[model samples]
Target: MARIAVIGAGMGAMAGAARLAVAGHRVVVYERTQTYGGAVRGFERDGFRFDTGPGLLPLPAVWRDLFLKTGREPLESHVEAVQVDPSARHVFADGTEAALPNASRAGVVAALDTALGAGAGQRWGDFLVRARESWDRTRRPLLEEPLWPNWRVLAEREPYPAVPHKRLLRTRRAGTLAEIGAWELRDPRLAALLESHALAYGLDPRTTPASAAVLPYMEHAFGTWYVRGGMRELARAVYERCLARGVEFRFGTEVTAVVEKDGRAAGVELAGGEAAEADFVVAGVAPDVLDRVAGGLAERAAGEVPARRSAASRLTVLLALRGARPEGTAHRTVVHAPDRDAELASVFDGAPGPSARPTVTVLRPDDPALVPDAGHEAVVLSATVPAALGAAADPGSRSGDPAAGAEELITAATRAIPGLRDRLLWHEVRTPADIEAATGAAGGAVPAPALAAAGGRLLHPANGTRTPGLFTVGGWSHPGGGLPHAGMSGALVAGLIVEGPEFRGSQ
Candidate 1:
């Protein structure tokens, strides 16, 4: 078996290590931080525990596949997930609130029709049906396969021309979210709502790809879920599974560089000049950071790097509230701005001034066992903000003042939820700088490869020029970000490493 070195210890690295270990390969995961989990890390302040990253959990089957492949069961031991009803409460500028149901297309349509107006539901249903078809046709060929030779093979097996008459690839790169929604949905409110969904990827609807329409479909069709404990528990579960599979984990050991022998990667050089050898290396850190670590490898492979429409960087506040559950508050809430375009422009322009109002998603742990008391609440408010607000002098350094940013975020969040400030017992804030420092993510990108830029032939790193033994994996590669996609990226890389070029050749 190969001596593999998995870098970062994030979900992607963890998944890769676990899978490699189960395959009987000697695997060692080197993490720069004192802890694992990357973006999924959690912390506590006062009597409140907060999950620092990934507030929601969807697609449980993805986790199941990761565990089952390693001879484990995620459902039986890892997480207790409950499907959320009325998945999210979206609040508009006119004070109209739409509680979206986590149900079938017809059920969702009925709810939308009742909430919005007559005929709106059927219109949405038709759109959903089309989106579902897009998802079904492309999920395996586009998302499941590695973006390398496999993509080409899959394309050949089912040529875009031969596939169902739906214009999947044709619409791959179309108008912005708002434009598409405006043209597709007749109602202005529904169009705005559809456009606003782009915020889920930290993107503005105006520039977001139409393919992103699949996001709402997946959430509504499969349902939005929450872990019984917290999202961080998912990372812990993966960590435990890795240990069971005999994977060696070394935390607090930062990877300073990827050492190369001739033209291929030999291993990694840890902080303070310690070096560990491996026949294969999979880096699960951000692409920009990976570019730096690989010593311009990313720049050299610039053509391969998926084009990115700048992803929204967040300014998040974690609040510990002492009060009974607030009435009319769903597990998730989205507060829309009067002009989302201007709001998004301010963030992108690095002028996320003190006055910008952001959509807030509050998570109240349903499991009594996870929290100390029913009166206490753990709330995380996140909104898109300027990257400069969280900038640091060094990429690897921790934030200079996280508390200051936290205060600013808290002040903003209170505006959306009245009396929110008064209820806070303790709080923490995470700026883009803080997230990058803590998780080694590029520009605090929660998930690498922003949704807008990942599409068609460019989805996978394996498709581009490759060094003899050097390979890349993680969210930065392709299918793109999110926990499930990252895990799948690692698996795809592993398959390529083991099976050679033929693995993804049929894609």
Candidate 2:
């Protein structure tokens, strides 16, 4: 049996470890932090619990596949996967609100028709139809399989069948997401609803490819899910699965370097000045720090997806409220920014600044375990912010309150949560600084899922590298970020290792 050493105990790394161990390999995971799950972390105070990372999970089939491949126990047995009905409530800039049902095209169309007047729902439903086409075209290449060697083919092609819109002189199909909104959706509120899907993943709708329609399609088609208790439970479940597979984890043991022998990844060097030899190595850390730890490993590969220097980060405010959550409240609510242009300008990924108002996502799970009692509630508010102006990189961001974005988030949240400030007992703000500390991501910038078009700028590096026996997984690599994509990254890495370079796709 080959000995495998994995760097980082994130979900992706652990997922790979579990599958490799089940393949009868000896795997040891070294994590710098005292916990697993990378950015999937939780915070608790006075009976109130908050998931500091992703509040809801989309495309849970990825995890289901992981569980099925690794063990007999279904994912449902470990954590209660509750399908959130009325998937989400969106409050448009025009004060119009729509509650979309989970995974029901007819229900969502009807709801949008009722809320946005005639023709709006039809437009959105049609858009989703086109988005589905994109999903069917790219799903295997982007999510299920290792990134193709000729990835530019995926990059240059736009699978989204955009409707022909005649703009005065020329008749052309919409190219970017913004064009999809303006040419097809027509209504500003519908545009806001469409763009919010991209925004939630830190992608700028203005420039994101039309192929990104797959983002919302994945949610609408699959449905959003919440783990019982908190999202941290999902991380705990995966960590446990790795342990069950005999994967060894050394927490708080940081990896300093990726040692090489015969020009192949030989093992890893630890911070304590000890070397652990292994036959193969897998890295799940962010792309920014990957070079530092692995000595420019990604750069050695030819024509791999360029490492994303920076992406949008999130500013989250965890609220401990005094009152019980009202029954019938939607599981998730998105309050769109009142001034779209202004908010978009300020929240640009590389340029951090305060927006007068920015789009905010408010999550209030119905789970009683999150609160001390029925008399209290746990609420999480998240807003996309620039990757920089972080205390770690910007002098200005450090000069003022690092959590200054909390006020902006709270202000935008007032639309979703009535009397929000009044209901609060206390609140804690977690900035990009916290993310950088937790995940070692520069400026805590979160990577978005890989998208076709935009000349392949959004695609991440390939799973295999120039250095043999070394593979990179997680958000920084192929298939890109988000829970499902990261999990798939692990699967791809295992496939490449177990089946060798000829590995095509999971059966």
Candidate 3:
């Protein structure tokens, strides 16, 4: 059995530690903060709680596989994952609404047809068929296996099969996601729906490859899920599972460096200069953090000096309300921006400032666990924003705080929540600064999940680094970010470590 040192107690690191321990290896995890879960965090006040990170989970099979591998207990037995039926309700700019069903393509089609009129549903349904092709073409190499040495092949090839469109007798296929929306979907509402998926992940639809269609396809196929209490409960279950498997954890202990010896990662150096020697070192941090901790060893292997990609952060406003959460309300609602083009330009290209009309996602779970009583409700409003590294937290600043972007979020969310301003008892803003302090990511940037194409810019570095025994896991590494991708990154890292360099992927 090998002695392994894992950095950070985030979901990805914990997943790896649990699996490694189950493989009979000794694993020790060092976390900078007194908590686990990384971005999957939650906040509680006076008996009310809100998930501060991702409010929902997609591709839960990732965690399910982890639990199955690490222990005999299934994930469902540890945490009650409730499928969010009518997965999400979308409120378009034109006062039109559609509630998409969870994991049912036909149902989604019917709902769209009913809400948006005839032909609209068929266009989206057809688009999904193409998206599925992208998923099938890329799933194995992108999510299941180790990133190939020549990752450029994946970057150069676009897996999404574009539909032929005849514009004035000339035939052309859609290249970017924006083209797919304009050429195929046609309707502005359908275009908005399609682009929203990419925007949520901090990708610019106009620039993102058509392969991104796989995103909506994945969600429609796998469905969205939520833990009974909050996403934090899932983290607690994973942490407990790690402990049950005999993996040791040290919270509030920051790892300063990856100790190297003879061109191999020997172990890690802690804040107080304490060294824990190991045969293998697993780092579950951002590329920037890895560059610092590993002394550029990781950056060299990644073929870049910094090894980090530009990331987008989130601006969230947690609302504590005095009214009961209405019964039969959809678990989540997306209020689309009034001006789609302007909104995209503001977020991706224009000066860092609040969008005059920003797209906002409103989350309000019906679980009583989130409210002080039957008379109260907890609502969370979130928007994608630029990550200004090392900046102070500005919650809806009056000084044109572009990074805050909270005011626009509030304005957009009003469409989703009735009498939102009236029921608001208190509100708290969670900014990028808070994320940086919590997760150690520069600028509190949240890395997007891996995509198939885009000249390799979207692909994460390989799990294995140049330095022998050194590996990168989590959102910043192979398979990229998001809860499911992070979990898969852990599995991939463990597979490489336990099965040797010849390891292809998880069995």
Top-scoring candidate (lDDT):
2
* Per-residue lDDT of model 3, residues 264-292, tens digit only: 99999999989999999999998778878
Candidate 1 lDDT, 350-433, residue by residue in tens:
443343444555565555644568887778777665444445642211223455445545654554567987887776766787
Please give the range of 10 consecutive residues that has the lowest summed lDDT in model 1: 157-166
Q: TM-score of model 2 relative to the true fold?
A: 0.97
Ranking by lDDT: 2, 3, 1
Q: Candidate 3, which segments miss by more than 4 Å at Cα?
A: 168-170, 301-306, 352-354, 389-404
Query: What TM-score would every model get versus the actual structure?
Result: 0.86, 0.97, 0.96
Question: lDDT, candidate 1, residue 445?
Answer: 61
Residue 296, candidate 2: how far off, in angstroms?
3.4
lDDT of 3: 0.86
How close to the true structure is residue 356 of candidate 1, measured as C-alpha lDDT?
45
